[model samples]
Target: MNKVSLLSSSVRQQSLQAVALLVFLVMGLSGAMGPTLIPAIRVVFGLGLSSAMTVQWIPLVVSGLSSLILAQLLHRFGAKAMVLGGLGLMTVGCLQVRLAILAPFGLDARYGLMLLALAVIALGTSVIQVAANLLVVQLGHARTASARLTLAQSFNSLGVLVGVSLGTTFALGAKTTTAPTMALGIGQAFGWSGAINAAVLAAAAMVAAGAWGVSRTSQAGQAPIRAALGSGWALAGAGGIALYVGAEGSIGSILIPFLHQKSVLNLTLEQAGHYLGWFYWGGALAGRLAGTWLLHRGAPAKWLGMAALGAVIASALAALGSGPVAGYAALTIGLFNAIMFPVIFSITVERSAAPSAAVSGLLSTAIAGGAILSALVGWTGEHFGFAVCFLVPMLAYGLIALFAGFGALLPSVDKAPQDSRMTSSVGNLSERT
Candidate 1:
């Protein structure tokens, strides 16, 4: 390709990157809105704690399974089809929940359908996430892969922030009780949060559908999924992403509750949320900025190691205390997690001997760890306490530390023998050293 053609191709490629970012924002919003509304949904539907948590787990399973299944879908039908399909699934799921509100059915019947809706949304978001993550890395310039993914994930955090803010606000406003009472009865406050989420999902689907043509042009051919799964570095990288995402989600998800349980500042639910939001928003923004900076400084693995250490320390501090200080520590771990998946993913993609789609599929499947780890923490919280519950994430962080220190020591998974003809299909297409 000539210089102009290359430039135009680059622009088209980055446009797809932008689309991926949009998908993350929508999925992130949908994923978070359900959790925010759980309290209200539980009260209105008369569900128990384990039941509410079970609703949360459903999404994780759906998302993970979809990621695993989607590789074939993308390989067969293409990323555009998968992206639009995911949006369609999420739209259907949200509508199901919205319809439940208007129905005359019994509470148990209504809640059961709502739970099913959440699962469908989860599966849809998972498909979108898998496709988007893979596309950004595959289509973008090779050297800038980390930068591309980081930019997209920053938007993911933005979605979470929006979801939490809107969910909490609407939930609180829907109640007739005093703010303090409403906050205390968290379940009563989240009823309308569900409806609000449905609106957002609809808007997102429209945007995704409009951009479908642009993203379809970016899809490229790739090797088989089975071959990619067999690669060692690809699997390790996926494991790294899984551990990082799970630890980050588990810690962030519980920060507000952990803060409210304390006596030091004795924060109300709203106040606790304000503090928790800062932790999430702060870590997300700061970590992404720092990750960009560190990528430029060289030695990405060293940076990864340092961040893992920070996680270990943060977990320890949060474990030792329960008040404002512990809350801060737990939230700050977002900073550590911010760069993890991007950094690890970049490394994996660079090292992959298999097709880009295969690598992306493995990483996407790893996201299921969020569901597994979250449930594990929930179990621990029930048996012991929140502080102790964090021990599971602490272990995940520790494993990340080991990976950062020794990732290079591990062998590559590509079955192809080392050859000068070996080439990277995605990004700038630069020859490996």
Candidate 2:
């Protein structure tokens, strides 16, 4: 078949869409569990706020470096093998965390081990996210890729919601912040998640055995990594995506505590977190649903600009408003942020066809922006208070908004159909398992 016909054939399968959606939800469960583990880790390990946040960065650091290597891995192993490998790593990492936490040890020693375990888990998650996202876009519709990402990510938010709630409940009922308590509680949690993930990974592996090359075209054969990295637009889009993720992560990490401290609502940490989840994840879910459709009618840049404007305005108002009103306004920004990451990623992916693999890796690395931006916000919150800390994300959104409005231009690919924007920098492949 011709390249166009081949790619079209790949996109016409409803089963592919079902698998993408299913895997995304499972991935979401794992991803969402990550943030909730943060607070529990802090309480059990007695780590400071900055230190606790650093744990979150481990995934980004590992993922960033790993993403750089994915192009090579894809070339060597193919997308199916690489994805299963990532999933296997994730399962192993989770099991290790569970074992480490359950180990009998001194507080300091246990804390060190916990951090190490978290690092391992982060590495696995990074690979999974990068693989899953690329696969979804590759196997699904092009114009609707961003929307599908948004919809899938909404499940990720739901996973977070469930994890935090469960984590907090288990944490609260646990013993002192001693090593043993941490070990027992966290270990159990990891154990459960690990077992579940292992089952999923095993199933994915079985499916992949039958699914390799299910969607690949002759034109989709390997491209040089250097060529993919050279696309200026892809790199720029990656930067924007990085900044956007950082802003969102920072906000989500700190906003609940900020609201509790400054607002007249006078809620507890758990209460604040729950409300934050509703505002953040709930809005995220809604926005993604809406954004999926919006991308078809308007330019991504325009929609991004609008989302950014909403974030800035809502955040600014939340900063100014007192009592419950201010808190709600601040929470409203989650709605705006809901679609930011997927949209930025989709735009970047759409703009360049020369380096699909490299571009995916580069864009995945942009997640590091979360670590840097969140730290900045935490610092600002310490010195200036929660309201002013938001200024950091506001600036981030503003720049991204500008990019959406004028700085970015989506190029039209001439020959390739499935993803004319494919780049050797990153390969967009579907996960059949």
TM-score of each: 0.82, 0.85
lDDT to native, each model: 0.65, 0.66
Q: Candidate 1, clashing residue pairs? A: 39-187, 40-187, 142-427, 142-428, 171-189, 232-413
* Tens-digit lDDT track of model 1 for 40-122: 55566665545666666677667677676787667566666677778777767766666664467776787777778788888
Give the number of the best model, judged by TM-score: 2
Q: Give the residue spans of candidate 2 off by over 4 A.
A: 1-15, 172-184, 212-223, 262-264, 407-410, 415-433
Model 2, residue 411: distance off in Å is 3.5
Query: Candidate 1: how many backbone clashes?
Result: 6
Per-residue lDDT tens digits of candidate 2, residues 1-433?
5888556545434434444455555555555444555556676677667776765566666667767676556555555666677767767877777766666777678667766766666666666666667766665456666776777677666656555555545542354645456446667766766776787677666555444432334324454556567877777777787778777777777665666674546775557667766777668777877877887777666788889999988777766777877678788888998778887877777677655666677888777666788787767776777778778888888888877864345563432443343222123433222
Task: Give per-candidate clash totals.
Answer: 6, 21
- Residue 353 in candidate 1 has what lDDT? 79
